[model samples]
Target: MTRIVVLGGTGYAGRHIVAEAVSRGHEVVAVSRSVPTDQVIGAEYVQGSALDVAPLAETLTAADAVVSALSPRGDMTDRALEALTNVAELLSGTSTRLGVVGGAGGSLIAPGGPRLFDQGFPEEYKHEAQVGIDSLAMLETTDSGLDWFFVHPAEVFGPWAEGERTGHYRDGGDVLVRDDEGKSYISGADFAVAVVDEIEQGNHHRERFTVGY
Candidate 1:
């Protein structure tokens, strides 16, 4: 079984990813500051912060891959990028692959066009959005010696969507994934499916990809 470590494993998207990965019989270690309300069976939960990676060195070093399901919230605001940098450095010489969750704001609004952030995303979400964008920027510009993959979800995604598991998804490059009707949406459950699939397949290496219905 693949030994997977999920950072921020109790957050909105992180929790779903942990559940999905565990369901697939992967050995999962969920790292979060607090435990989840409903923990998945057969998964290990560790209480810690990604901000401090020194103590987590062993956990990260031994993992087959690390998923940055981290979302900037509360004190985490404006700190995701920093945390990501530390993680990349910790896994620099290791064989662990890094999978970072991306936001729709960083994705292109169209093919070879401006990004969603450039078009003026809602002010309320700008800070959190920029954190995701900055994390991707670091991945693209720096040579941290870490094999990284950034996965962007649809514009409308999260636990609130409460969508069904169609067990089907479409993957694309930096461009946002939309249906024929031009609707951009995906359920959190489906996003987890895409994430775990990529981890197992090792596709889209060192690239940013988006997934949606």
Candidate 2:
């Protein structure tokens, strides 16, 4: 089984990812600034900050994949990109795959046209969205030997709309995934499923993909 390291493990997206990975019998290490009251049974939670990667060197060395579920918010608003960049640098030229959970804003509205961020996006979320875009750009320029993948979840993905796990989702390459009604959404658990699937399948190397119903 894969040994997975989740940087923002205590967060919403990170927790789901840790749970999904553990449920699949993969070795998972959840790293965060604080510990959670509830924990995933089979996963190991480490109290640490992603901003400082030097201390996490040993913990990250043997990982088969390192997933960055970090969101640019609160104290991390300005440093999220730095943390991810450091992680990318650490995994460069290594066998460890870097998987990033990006925002919907970076996704294209069409095949090769406007992006969701170019349209009227909420002002409050602009910073976080830009971080996602920048993170993908950073990955694109990394060492060719560094295998990686960026995932943009549905427009409505978050704790607010935490739906049940259906064990199914669609892969929208570069474009946003929406239903017939033009609604872009996916449950947290299902998104985690897509992530683990990618980790195991290694389908899209060094590229970005969107996930939704």
Candidate 3:
């Protein structure tokens, strides 16, 4: 079983990915600033923040893969690029792969259209969205050659939707995913499925992909 480390594993998206990884019989290590009241049965939880880099690097060395499931919030909205750059540097030359839980705002609405962040998105969410966009930009241009993937969710994604685990989702490039109903959504549980599938299958290397119904 692959030993996987998830930074921000107690958060909304991270918990689901942890659950999915454990269900697949992989060794899961979850690191977060605070402990979760409820823990996954087979996962190991570590209480720590990424802001403390030395200890975080120790966890990276022991993992076969690492998923940065962090969102841009509070001070993190400004510091995400630094945090992610550290991750890229830490994983450089190691076999451990990196996967980022990305925001849809950086994704294009069409093949050659403007990104969601540039299309007059809600004002309140702009800062956090810009962080994700910047993180993606940084990863794409970084000189370090690390195996990584930035997986973005659909426009409607969160715990509120909580859709069922169909174990199925359509994958797309930089563009967002949509259906005939013009509703693009994916439950956290199923998003985890896609994440684990990517971790195991190793498809779409060094690029961004999205998952939705």
Candidate 4:
């Protein structure tokens, strides 16, 4: 079983990913600002801020891979991105692989053209989405020796709908995927499935990929 560490495990998408990882028989260590009293079965939860490097390093030691699902609310996007970058730095020089959760804003709407957020992104989400987009760019330029993969979800994510474990999704190369209704969306459960699938199969290495139903 792979020893995996999940940053921001208490959040919406992170929690789903943690559940999926544990269900697959992988040993998971979840790190967040606060530990859930009712933690997921077969997983270890650690309470710590992602901004702190020492504790994060200690938590991630000997981990097979690290999944970063950390996000900031509103204007805290820059701070959140900085903290995540610090975590990436700590994982450098280790055997751990990094899988980062990216924002739809960074994914291409067209080849070599505008991003999702660029094309009429909601003002309310602009700051946080930009943070995610910037974080993906930072990961791309990181000189650290860590092997990393960035996964971008569709326009709709989180616990908006109760979606079943289809165990199926279509992967796209940096571009967004839309259905017959000319819309793009993914359930948090399906997104978690995609994340764990990548971890187990090791597809889309050292690059970014987008997912949709």
lDDT (10s digit) by residue, model 1, range 1-213: 999999999887888889899999999999998887688888899988879999999999999999998888888877878888889888876789999998999999889978888887899989888889889888887575778899999989976787988888999788999999998898988999999999999988789999998
What are the RMSD figures for all models against the true structure?
1.1, 0.7, 1.3, 1.6
Instruction: Report the candidate with higher lDDT, 1 versus 2.
Output: 2
Flag clash pairs in model 4.
none
What does candidate 4's lDDT look like per residue over 132-187, in tens digits? 88888888887758788999998777676657777888898889877779788888
Model 2 agreement with the true structure over 130-207: per-residue lDDT tens digits: 999999999999979899999999999999999999999999999999999999999999999999999999999999
Candidate 3 vs 4: which has more TM-score: 3
TM-score of each: 0.96, 0.98, 0.95, 0.94
**Highest TM-score scorer:** 2
lDDT of 4 at 81: 87
Reference-based lDDT, each prediction: 0.89, 0.94, 0.87, 0.85
Q: Quick one: best lDDT, which candidate?
A: 2
Cα RMSD for predicted model 4: 1.6
Please identify which of the two predictions, 1 or 2, would achieve the higher TM-score against the true structure. 2
Tell me the lDDT of model 2 at 121. 91
Candidate 2: stretches off by over 4 Å:
none
Write down the worst ten-residue block by lDDT for model 3: 48-57
